[model samples]
Every structure is written in structure tokens, then in C-alpha cells.
Target: MTHEPSGLKIIDRFSISLVRCEKRPTSPFGCKVGLRSVIIHSVLLCSSFKKSRKYSDVGKLNKINFDSLKRPDYVRTLTIRCRHLSRKESNPAAGVFRDFRNLDRLEIDRCHLKSLPSALFSGLQNLYSLVVKNAKLSVIPLDLFAYTPNMMTLDLAGNELRIEPYALRSLRNLIHLDLSNNSIDFVTNTLISLTKLKVLTMDNNRLTNIDFRRLPKTLTDLSLRNNFITTIHYVSGSVRNLRRIDLSGNRLDFIAGSGSINMLPPSLRQIDLSNNQIAFIEDKSLAELKMLAVLNLKDNQLTELKVESLSGPENRLRLLLGRNPFKCHCGIRWLIHSTEKTYPVVLDLSELNCSSLLNDNQKLSLTVADQRNLLICQYDILCPTSCICCDKPVCSCRSSCPPKCRCYRSANMESAQKTRNVVMCEKMRFDGSEEIPDTITELQINSVQLEQWDIKKLQKLRALETIRISNTSITDDQANSLYSSRVLMELQLSSTNITKVPSNIGNLSQLILIDNPLTQLTNGDISVSEIFPQSLKLEKNQL
Candidate 1:
């Protein structure tokens, strides 16, 4: 055994030897002479020494003299961190690692390297894994790995390299390759050489297209997220072993069913198509994926998704349908009726919103139970320009004052019975050609312009019980027929052009005639009101 030099410490514990070559200013070139070489020969010669060496915070002068190492074949694993190597060597990386013939695993991190010499890895045929991450490498020479044909795993992520054809021809046994976070816009011919690749990740790149026919048939997991790809083309029998595929964050607008545009492999277990422009998925598009478990379709433009589209052999599928602008219609009945026995498990139902008949906008879960009556299959009955017609239970109706004058169902009113449906109109201009459904028991109108014929139509609502109109103009003749409703209990006529109160004003329980042009309230009006015993609101008037 050689004597230990200054700044070089040796620790032996439990058949494991650690040689640390730390900095010493007095030593030549800021490092102990023969520090790493001597440690390798002395410590590695032992029968119990581990074959792994880790160099931390390696400085410029603590250069690893690979040529001086006596037993390079004994070394198996080498990891270097924060070691900024100079680019001036004729064969920069080859000169550093050429002697480690028996090296199996090597990892270089945070080196800030911009380029690699053509003969960077010229003599490491036994290498199994190599990682060069967080560097500024722009290009990988086609023959860079010609000497390392047995390498199985190569991760060159976080670089600026644009892969070229035959760049990885030597890696025939590669199993996992990660080229994520790079500037490669096109890789049409770069991966055909890796025949045994199982997992490949090319995330956060500029790839615009992916031809699945060119992918290795042995692949099981492939992720191409955050790319510019508009469509994926997959020929039959290609990528048959693929189990998980992530094609999220793209511009895919539609997914056609089998025998159509894109045909997916049947062995897939997970498919992620979130955050795209997908508006439609053809019926049974993904039904063939019998083994699929997780289908993520969140953050898209889907208006309706059918349950049959997600059919599989088992009930293990979880459908992700959040952040989509789904319309409230019978087309979405599949989602509304999704159950454990009927369809796949749905996630984020509360995060989905839709425009429905009764409510313009509401959470999808709120309308699921009442979807049968709320979601109309088609718009057979057209409403006026500013009106919306919704189906409600035949419950008694309540009227709200402007500017929110929408009608709603109320069964707790003092003088009401749940008899017929109601249609509340706001800012409506009736043309008399339109027929209000005869099933309404209450009619509330705000900012409505009603004609003479329109009044005749309302006068015949046999179930009419409440009449509330505001911000309108009415004549004495119109008032006569309006206040003459036999079943009317409450009447409100505010902000109107009426000059006189109806002769039968006292017939109602509640009267709101404010904001009118009445100049005089005749004695008959007050005396009739006092005798009939009603609630009156006559504010904002001239009387």
C-alpha cells in the first residue's frame, strides 16, 4: 500500500474504502499529486473495496488524470457533479474517460458543456448507462456513441440539441431514452436505430408531428407532451406494446374512431389528451381500448361526450371531463346518467359547467338529477329575441322586480297552489305571432312591449293567477281587460304610461302601481281599496 499524501484522506469501514482527494493550496496545481490515481490503485486492489467513485465539487486544477490510473478495469461506476471541464482538449471527453474500460455507469451533472468532441466516448464499450444533463449541448455527433454499443440507458435532457439521423445508431440495446426539454423540432429518422427502446420521453420539444409507424414496437410508455403536434398517425400493429401515452398540450381538434384517421393500439392502459382544442370525439373512438384505465380529456372544447365512446371490457376506467364548455342538452345525458353499473367512473363532475334551460350557467352536477326535464334534445319552440323559455314544475310562480325579473317556482306563497308552469319574460317585445304556452299559471313581464293582440292572448290563460308588468305602456282599454282577470290575486303595474287606475283595482290582494303618470286618485279608488282590504304601493306617482 502506498503512503497517503497531504489533502488526501482514506477511510475504511466495514469492507468499504473511501478515498477523498480534497483541495490543498500548497499542493501542485491546487491538487495533491497522484491523489486520484494513487487512491484508485491502492484502494481498488483490495478484495473488499467497492468499485464506485464519487467526485464532488471538482475544481479546474483537480483534473482527473485518467491515464495514470493503474487498474482502470476495476472501476465500474463514476459520478461527477459540478465539474466544469475545459473544452480545449483535442478529444475532450475521450481524454477523460478513455481509460475507464470496465465502467458500467457514468453520470455528469451541471457541467455547462456546450459541445462534445467527436471522439468523446471512444473506448467505453461496456457502459450500460450514461447521463449528461443540464448542459448547453447543441448537437450530438452521429458517431459519438459508436464505441458504446452496449449502452442501455441514455438521458441527455435539458440541452439544445437537434437530433439528426443515425445519431444513435450504436445504441442497439438501449431500453430507456430521455431527450426532454430540448430544441429538436424534427426527429423523423433519429430513433429507428434503437430497436429495444421501452420508455421514451420527448416532452417540451418543438415536434409538430408523430408517425407511430416509425416507433419501436417494443415501447410500452411514450410521452410527447408540450409539443406543436396537430395530429398523430398510427398504422395498425405499430406500438402494440405501448401501455401509456401522454399527448397533452397540443392542437388536436378531433379524434376519429377506428378505421378512420388515427388508430390507437389496443394494449394501451392510459391516454392523456388534456389541454387541447379537441371539440369532438367520434363515437366508439376509444372503445377498442379495452385495457384503458385513465382517460384524461380535461380543458378542451367538448360540448358533449357519449358514454359509449368510453366503453371498455371492465369498469376500471376513470373519465376526466373537467374545464370543458358542455352545453346543457340531451346529448349530455350520458354524463348525467353515469353510474357504477352504466358507465366509467367520472372525475371532476363539479368542475364542469353547462348552459341549461332553467339556469343559463350552472355546475354539471346540479343538473344531473333533473336532466330529464331540464335538457331538451332540440329547440322545437323558438323564443323571442330577448326571451328564454325553460320547463318548470307546474308550481305557483313568483315575480321579482327589475333588473332581475326572472320567474321562478315557489310553493310556499300565501295564496297559491302548484297548478301550472310559468314563463317569465324580460325585455320582451311581443309581436302577437308568438303563442305563450297555455299551461302557465303566472305571467311576469319586465321592460316588455305588448300589443293589443298580445293582451287578448294573455286574457285567455285559463290558469292565470298572478299578473306582474313593469316598464311598459298601457292604455285605458288594455287596463280594463288586464285588471279583469277572474283568478288574479296580485297585480303590479310600475313605470307604465297608464293615466288612470282600473275600476276593479281593489279586487286584488296586492297592488303595486308606482312610477306611473296618474295625476289624481279618484275617491272611488281609495274607498274601494279601503273596503277590499289590500296591500298597495303607490309611490313615485303624481297623485
Candidate 2:
């Protein structure tokens, strides 16, 4: 055979005799260059050919591809590009790729191959990965991966089409499957047989629902971003090994069965439900994800957050609720008062914009704006010699501490701080014999003898807002109680006398000064804030 000056050979040069009426498959390009020229091009592309040249079309990302090609090369990995295999030009001879058994990966990119030979991948036994991106492929045959049993990854992105049932049943060893950016409208058993699958990315598709109970339990990460998904039905029996799940940018209004289901697999660590239409989440929903460390709810439809929702034991959890329409009302007092420590809660309060408070036009930083928003106080509690102010917007001679600490509208006392209703206590002797009742809001004992305060059940006052004991050294339990509440807005105490302030402080109450005489200051020691009560009648012997 003779080669042309351009390095391409003509079919006529090979003297390949053709019968007058031989049956031949038509190529979409119109003309058949003959099997001889195709073989010559194959030799040119072979890596073992010492004189073979490497031809690459660099700027050809802009170039359109034609279909129906003969074999191009015999390499360890085959990359078939720029071919438009329409139904009329679908050549069965393309099955020649099956001869490349040593091939480990296959790429059919940027082509219009609407149909492929069923046996196209039949001989690629060692193939490890298969990629068919932007190929305009509309359907995947059931046995497409029949011969590639060792395949571990299948990336079929940008192929908006349908998949035959059991399409991937043969890929038993597959661990990663990506079907993103497709137009698939439904999903069936196409993935039910992948018992070993680990990572599945089905983003940018048209999927509207997902029944996790039908998926493989071996999955560790599953991403379904940017879809039309409105529901994700899951049971505890599914995804027992899954750790990370992402369902962002969907159309879900709320998490189905998120609450009351002790059914989420404990293996869960991260959940991303961001950029959706979610408006509310129940506390049990938060509790269902028991071991979760990260929860992202950014850019959603949430307006209010109940403090009780985060009363779970996951202290290390980092909740992301930014970009949502959060109304800064008394309903969110649990976060403002920092009572999270009571139930052990911490949130990623960064970038959380408040929509209802202050300037609605300008977004408020949740972390920075929280302090100013929570300056509300509502009690004029009469304290002891070492008094505490539980909740008094304008503290004075009038004592108004909550009698029993009841603000929560819900039966859950865990969120008592969220409600505006409050009660402050009056001065009472901490007579050890009284066995301080659990209902008291503030307990002020002016007992002088150290032995006088030990008889009271200080720890039993679960609802107690403040404890004022003077001239007595702090005990570990009492110190813990005080450390836990010494800084409480109602139990206001000077840091000069208090020890290390714990990092986990929930709510802080401000001293509300109502109609009363100004605090009489004495030396720096008697700062206006140090006075037990502005209305306390000064005895002649004391002054």
C-alpha cells in the first residue's frame, strides 16, 4: 500500500477487491473510506509504532464531532472522541473495541452517539473505569458493563437520557458512580444491584424523589444536588454505613420524617440540606441525627428556630443556618441567652442574617447582633446581702424575679428563656432548715456562720435562677451551680468575686432600673452595680 503526501492512505491503494453488490454499513459521514484506510490510521495511533505521530486538535473544544468511526488505536486505555453515532450509522463493527482486552478505561466524550452496539464493551474485561460524558447517549443497555466486571468507576455525566433496568447489575465491584448533569426524570433498579457502591453523585438531574431503602447499604457518600427532589424517603434499615449525605439546591419544603424517627443510621456524620425550600425542622428531627457533626441549612425558608430542637446530646454539633429568613423575636431567645450549655448546644452563628429585627435592608451578623438583641430584662428581684438580679429590665427597690422560672410556651422547660414571661424573687433567709424548695427563682442567704448554709438543698433547685450566700466559702457543687448561673442576667454578680467564667454560658439578663433612687456608691468597692437592691433601707448601724 502507498501513503499520500499528507500521511493518510487511500483505500484504493491496498487493492482490496470488493464485490459488485457487497453489503456495507453506512457511516454518518456519508462515504466509506474502506477498512484499509481505517487500519492505516490505527497503526498511526499505536504507541508501539516507532514512527507513529501524535495528532491532537488543541483548540477543538469548539469543533463539532462526526460519528461512525472504525477502530482508531490499540492502546492500554481507549479514548474515543468526537464521533456522532446516530441510529442510521450505528455500525456493529464498532464491537472491534472488544478486542482490546487490556483496556482499563474508556472515554466517549463530546459526541452525538445516540446508540451503541450492545457488545461494544464485551471484550474489555480488565476495564476499570468507563466515562461517557456529553455523548448525547439516550439509553444505557442492560448489559453494557457485562464484560467489565472489574470496573470500579462509571462516570456518565452530561448524558440526559434513560437507563435500562439492571443497567449496572454487572458492575458488582463498582465503588463510584457519577450521573450528574443529566435529564433523567426517573430512577428504578438501575442501581439496586451495586452492593459494593460507595460514592454516588447524581446532581443536576431531573430526579424528583429518592427512596434510600432501595439503595445499597455500602454507600458512604451520596450527593443529589440541584435536582427537583421534593422527597427523600429513608428508613433506619437503609444506608447503615453512610456517613455523608448532600441534598442541596432542591425543592423540598421540609425533611420528611425528620422528627420522631430514631431511624437515621448512627453512622451519619454530615448532612447538607442547603439552598432548599425548608421552612421548619422539629426537635426530634435534630435528635434523629444523633451522631451528626455538621448540619447545613443555609439559604432556606426558615423564619423561627425553637431552642428545644437543639436539646440533643450532640454537643460538638455545628449547625449552619445562615442565609435563612430568621425573625429575631422572643422565639429565638434560647440562642441569645446562651442557655445552650444547659442542654449543651453550639451553633455556627456566622453569616446568619436577621430579617425581622433592626434594619431589614442590611443583613445583620448573627454572632455580633445577638448581644444587642438579647438585652431584654423583665424582673425587679429583691436580692440578699450578696444579691443577684435574675430578670429586671429596670432594677430598683421593686423585686420582680420569676417566682418559678416559667417562660416557655411549650411544655418543654428546656426553652423557658424563649418566652417573654418572667418572674423574680423577693428576699428570703436561706435558713438551712427550710430545705430550699425547687420552685424558688432566687435564693439569698445572709447567714454569717459558714456552717449555716450547708443544710439547704442548693443543687435541688433545678429551676433556681440565682443563689446569694454571703461570708461563706464556695463549695464545689455550689461553685459549679454559681459558675453555671453567676453570670445569668438575673443572677448578676461582680467578676471581682467570681472565679473563671465558663465558656458555655447560655442567657445573660440585664439589670432593669425602674423608678428608684440611684445606687449609692462607696469607694470603687461599692460600685453602683454592687448594691444588692437600690431600695434596700440602710440601717443606721450598717452605714
Candidate 3:
């Protein structure tokens, strides 16, 4: 009496409250109860009902028990919430959705319905969203939705659905379909015909293979999680145009991008292949994913990952590579000291765990950046050592590291690989006539120890670009070789007793002379008089 004075009905025994009244006919089959929403609290929904059923009358309202019944023919929205009734409970009836004419949204969750009559929903002409889940229905009865052609979203998860070909051919407007946590295995033309479909979720199914070539190109998001998918076959030049796809919890060992072509469409932005059996990805195939921005490869087998390989100018990808057994060795040095400009670097670098060869359970992790330095790290090579006659895999300290020297990448190299680099041979660690690595592109030293560093050895690094020397003294012979050096664009000298400029040093872009007493310009030491080349910036010195 307090709620709706005329058309509204609020039943306390059955816990049904109708919201927002819309005036319509009050007939048995007419949709004119004036209620916009129907909330059924405790109602025994049966498979069938007799005609003109009006068992419970609120006009005779007092304390009512179960078995309250109504025609419910005009209900526009209906929900049956029985979490304890998800299995088949037989009830002799003709059909469930017999006279629901104006129903737009219907949910039958947590109900045990063994089968549905073909014409169960033959009366719903305006239904848009249908969710029939947590039911033990193994098969979708033929033509069950033939009358409800206006359904937009079909969520039938937690059901034993053996999806057959053309199972959803009647749903032309359905865009989002969630059949996750079902027993449906392989996919057929059962779904490809829905050209308008954009998102499909079939996670936790028994699927083995999904023919990528036949998949709908119009689909933007597809999820096939927790399946037995090992190989994904697609054709060349005909890759699916998806924005995101999740294939997590599969049995994939390698990602070779299918036959004859390594192509992932440019439309794809994120891919999740986590918790799979993936050992490695083909490098050539990865580069084909040109537009990927986020990649998840967690809980897989990956040892040496060149971070630059997964990203480039076209794709600056963030990677999730946690829970993989990583070797703490030189193979991953490129990831540590790489100079290449890989964009959107991995944010989860801290989770990169290490498994050493000596003791797999030794609880080792990636050495901190400082400990990664070869000069400071290789001394102990705490990892198991191997001398494999040079044909060994990368990350073997004995195979890659020189006896003792800290190596760093060259500034010009723009990859996450340490292929082109320089070495720092501190004066204290220098012994006379040490063979400087031919790979060193720029050399730096604190003292002019020509006998130990061998200034003439600089000619070996044809790629050398810069040199910094805090010299104790520069001999005449050293100055002659230094001035004629043609590979240098920058040169720096810092010495308290020294002062000089190379005659032919105009070819240098920048010449930094730091803290030197240069009162005189003669005595084989030339000082700047007026000006020099355009690219030179002469710093503090005793003029």
C-alpha cells in the first residue's frame, strides 16, 4: 500500500519488486503490468505451466509460503537466481518462455536444466540479451532461439556445450559471445558466419587447433585461454586483423608464425601467450609483428632474449617475461649493456630470476648492474665455467669475457645487443703490452701509460670514435701517433703538468682540454693562438 497506489506490485513473500511503471494492458498475455523490471527472489521456475495460472493473489495477502505462481506473460525483464539449482531438476512442462512477449533481457543462471524445448523462446519477439549459464545443458536444442532473433549478447558459460557447425547461424547481430568454462572443443564454421561479431571468449575449453586462416578478420578481440592449442596455422598475406588475442595456458612449444611466412598483422597491439609450453620464438617471425605494443610471455622457457629483437622504430613493446628459468651469464649481457634505442622497455625487469648451472637451486638472480661489469664480475665467474673451444653458446663467461676488463657498449650502437662496444682498462689493472680488444670502439684511461696500454694498439679499433686521457705525460712519439689518428671525432686530455694541441686536430669535432698548465706554446707543444675549426669547444686551461 505504501509503494504503487494502482499498478505497482511489491510481493514480500516471493521478494519481487517491480520498478518504474509503464501503463499497458492488464490481461493475462498482455505486457501491461506497469513494471519495468522484475526481480524474482524465491520462485520455483518450472519447465511448463498450465494456461491462465494465477495461484498466488496478493489481494489475499497474508503470510504466504512457497508455490506462489503467476502467468508472468507481460514481464519485460526476468531473472531466476537459484545458485543451488545448477543441475537438471525435471519438471513436466510444455516450455519455459512460452508467453514472454515483450521480454528484452532474460537470465536463467544457476539452474539445472537438462534440455530446452525447441520453441521455449518462441514468444520473445524483442529479446536483446540472453544469459543461460551454470546449467548442465550439453547441447543447444535445435531452433531454441529461432524466434528470438534480436538477441545481442549470448553468455552461456559454465555449461557443457558441444558447439556444432551453424550453432549460432541465427544470431546475426550478436557481437559479444562468452562461452568460457565450457567443454566445447574444436571450432568450425559455427561462429565464423557471424561477420558482425567483434569479441569472442572461449576460454577454458578443450580446443586443440584454431584455423587462423578461417578466423573472422573482423574480430577485434579473441580469447582461447586454457586450451590444448599447440599449432596455429595461417596462410601468407592473410593474417587475422585482431587488436588483441589471449592464448594463455596452452601447449605451445614454439611460435614460428605458421607456414612460409612470419606475419602478424599490423592491427594487433597486444598478445598474451603466457603459461604455455613455449621454449622460444623464431626471431625472424617476431620481427613480422610490426605493431605489437604489449607482449606477455610469462612462465615459458627463454634463455637469451635480445630485448631489441622484440621492439623497433615501429613497435615499442612492453614485455612480461616472469617465472622463466634464466641463466645468469654472458648470453644476457646485451640486455644489460645494450646501446640500441629499444622503446617502451620492459617494466618488470626486477622479476627476472636466475638459475645458475653450478647449482640450479642456488637462488641466484640477475647481477645488479654494477656486478654485471665484466672486469668486476668475471673474476669469480661464480657460475659454472666451460671452455667449449669457441663454438659455445653465448653467456658462457669463459667463452666471451677477456681475462679482465670492464666492457661497455659504444654510443653509436643503437641496439639492446652489445655487439659493438668499448672496454675500460683501468690504469691500475693495466700490464704492459696487453692486447686491447679489437672490438673496443672508444678507449679511456687515467694515466698516459703507453708501455702498458700501447698507444699504437689504438689502430686496431678501426671503429674507435673518442679517446679520453688524464695523462701524466705525453712523449713526442705518442703525440705524433695521436695527432695522425684519423678515426677520432672527440679527444679529451686532462693533466696538471701538460699543455699542447695537435697541429692537424682541426679534423676533430670537440677537443676538451681539462685542467692543464699551458704557460708556453713552444717546446714541441703547440697552444691555440687565435681560433680553430667550427666544431671545437676549448675548455679551462692555463693560457
Candidate 4:
């Protein structure tokens, strides 16, 4: 009985049938010559396999013979670090790795593999790629990618997956599908029918909501960063070949006023929404994103901002607005006038200061001429009756005036100005019932057309200091007859048509000119310091 067709005698009869089945062989032609030399070395290694070996062979025995089957044609790739197999020791009937049909690539890092046994890779059908990183698998077998139909890439990143719902219904020719740092909350509908999926990393997981409308419509790239999103409505009408979306550290405060990334599809560019809490962003929410560029909105709470909120200047946006709370006022003066004409290099605006107007002062950059000189000093210090007389009493008005006024009291300098202290009626205007005479201190009747002062008129001015009738057409009974003057100090009237502003002017307390532009500063002709009031100052003659 002679037989020897050296492929080294078919590796010495497959190493003596694994050393006679590890010495458990009870003779009988030693188990029929080790099953006929493993069916003639698996038919000479499946006729020298490789039509890229289609998932590597699980069906080619052709009446097994060759003195007892024993095939294994030089395995391709199969790493397994941190391995912990067990389920009765990875049973293929406990023959672990019984036959690795030309395995393509199968790494199993940090494995503890909880469950997986449905012909685990049924003799490897040319598996393209399959990494199970940090596996702690909770549940995955639903025919796990049904014997690798040429899997492109499938890394189950940091797993604990409970994902089931056609758990990847046989990976439809998967492209790249990393289940990133998993603890996956939900993603059903057969994992969005992997329609030849492009790249879909489920970042950080625990997702609050994401309905990419039944995904896999050739998704471009998506990451759902640090989950638990408050509201995003997943780009509305189905991902239309989405480009890129991260959604940084979610809990989004706003973004679903009816989705509208200009109705996406234009191959969306990129979006993050950094550290979400987004205070406001309406203006057509990214107005027709004509292929959006990039937006972050770092550390939100944004006081005010508008560039159509994000898609103005015909869509070539680039904004960040670093660490918000920004209230330099007048709605951030149109982002400092559109960051000096369109995205001034993605507008960082030097870490955008102003957290609730200048506190201890200093951070103020914003220029379009400082937002039009702060809306023209908040409209000439708040309009109403622009006034500012000075002849002593720079601000907290310090009394001292003139008396007895019938008008011409010259008495040849009446004994060198006998007790009329000092008065400087700077921006003057007076008429009828003229009893302001206590030898008037400092009265600035700016813009006055004093129709007919009533409400007991300045109650016979005792020792008035500074009084400004800013842009006046006065009446609140003439500002409660100059706030019932009890040694009147400083007073101002901003932009007139006074609707309300007399609460006794906080009882003057040596009042510091209360900014008065009379409100409704500016919105259209685009000026009034862009709409000022970081705390009011206005003096260029009230612009």
C-alpha cells in the first residue's frame, strides 16, 4: 500500500492527524488512516483557492477522501488579543477554529465576547474586515453580519451594545461602520438599512433622539458626539447624502424650528454646535444653507447675534462666537457689522468679550466704528431732550444759584453779586410762569419748546444744580414738573415722545444724568451706534 504525493506528504498527513487526535485514537487503521488523510488534504487545498476566495470556502468537499481530510491553506489574518472566549470554550463543537476558510481579517481586541455562536463566521466567507475593539458585548447575534458578505469595515468600538433590529441585516456591503464608544441607546429599523453606508460612527452614545429618516441613504459622515441631544429633529426630510455632523456635547437648546438647513441635500458641509445650550439662533435658522461652510457656537448662552442668525451675506458662513453671554448690546451690532464684511477669517473676534455689558470695564473690541459709536451714544445719550449744561457741578450736581428774576437784575453787579451763588443755564430754553428763579443754579433747557410748564413748575427752584431738558417736547406733566425739584441735581431726557420715565427720577440723590435718547434708537437706517446702551453716555450733542 504505497501513497505519497508530497506537498510534503500533505504536511505529513496533517501532523499525524493532530498527533492521533492528541493520543485518543483507538486504532482501526488508526481511524481509517486519519479519515483518509483528511480527504486528500481538503482536495489539494480546494484546488489552489483564490477567486479572492469568496468568503473563503465552507462548501467544497466533493465526496471527501484523500486518506482523511486535513485542509488549511495558509490563513490570511486573524488576531485576537485580550481573548476570553468561553461559551463552552468557543465551541464549534469544541474544535475551536475547526476550519478558517481563508479568513480575510478578523481582529478581536480587548475581548470578553459575551455571545456569538451561530456558526461564528461559518467557515469564513472571505471576511473583508471585522474588528471588535474593547468588546464587552451584551447582545449582537442576529446572524452577526451573516457570515461576512465581503464586509468592508465593521469595528464595534468600545462595545456594550444591545443593538438589535436586524442588527445590521447582513451588513449590506458595509462601507465603514464604527459603533463608537458604545453603550448604544437606540438605532433600530434594521440599523437604518445600511444602504451601502458610508461612514457612521456613533460617538459617545446614549442618544436622546436621532431619526435620520431611516438612514443609510448613502450617508456621508455622521458622529452624534457625546449624546443626549435636546432637539435636532435629525435634519428633517431625510439625510440627503449628508456631509458631516458632530453635534458636540449635546443638550441642544434650539435648532428645530422646523429643521431647515436650507432643506439640506446640497451636500451639507459641516456642523458641530459646540458644548450646546444655544441661547438663540432664529433668523430663518441658517437661512437657506447654500452648502453651509462651518459653524461651532462654542460654549453658548449667546446674548445677541445676527447675520440672519447664520446664513446671511448669501451663505458663505463661518462663525464661532467663543464662550458666549455676549451682551455688548444692540444685538451685538450685527456681529460687529458682519465681522467687517463677510467672515473675517471665520470671525473669532478675539474671544468675543462683553459678558453682560462692561462690568469692571475693559473688553470692548466690536467695531463698525464701535457699532456706530454705540448707536450714536445710544442716540445722543437717549434723545428725549438732549441737554448738558456745565458751570460747576460736573455730574452729581452740587447746589448754588441766583435768585429774584424778573429778568434784568443788574444793579451794577449788585454789591459784587450778592448771593446769587453761580448759575450757568447752558443749553437754555424758558417760557411762561417763569418761577425757576431762586437765581437759577445750572439749568440746561436743551431743545426746549416748553409749551406751557404745569405740574407746579420746578416748585420755585431753591438751589438747583444741573438740569438738562434733552430733546424735549416734554410732558409727563413736563417730567412731573422737573421731578418736583428739591434742589434738583442732574436730569436728562432721552429721545422724546416720553411714554414713561418719571418715577421721581429715583429721587435725584444728586442724580447723575440719566441717559436719554428717548428710546427707539435705530433699527433700519442702521445707526444709533447700531443701537447703543452698554450703560448710556451719549454727548456728541446727542448726535
Writing each residue's lDDT as its tens digit, candidate 4 over 216-284 gives: 768888887888867544454577778888878887776532443223344577777788887877765
The residue-by-residue lDDT of candidate 3 on 413-517, one tens digit each, is 333443334455555545532355444555666653445435556656677777776755655456546656777777767773554555556446777767777
Model 4 TM-score relative to the real fold: 0.30
Worst 10 residues of 2 by lDDT: 61-70
Off by over 4 Å in 4: 1-110, 113-122, 126-133, 136-149, 159-172, 182-196, 202-219, 224-240, 250-266, 269-272, 276-288, 291-303, 312-328, 332-543
* Ten contiguous residues minimizing lDDT sum, candidate 3: 58-67
Provide the global lDDT of candidate 3 against the true structure.
0.60
The TM-scores of all predictions, comma-separated, are 0.66, 0.56, 0.57, 0.30
Give the distance in Å from residue 359's predicted Cα in candidate 1 to where it truly belongs.
5.6
| Better structure of 1 and 4 per TM-score | 1
lDDT of each: 0.66, 0.55, 0.60, 0.53
Error of 4 at 153 (Å): 7.1
Q: Rank the candidates by TM-score, best first.
A: 1, 3, 2, 4
Which candidate model has the greater lDDT, 2 or 4?
2
Per-candidate RMSD, Å: 9.5, 16.7, 16.7, 21.7
**lDDT head-to-head 2 vs 3, winner:** 3
Backbone clash tally (model 3): 6
Greater lDDT among 3 and 4 belongs to 3
Top lDDT prediction, candidate number: 1
In model 2, which runs have C-alpha deviations exceeding 4 angstroms?
A: 1-74, 83-92, 163-165, 256-265, 311-315, 333-348, 357-363, 374-543
Sort by lDDT, top down from the best:
1, 3, 2, 4
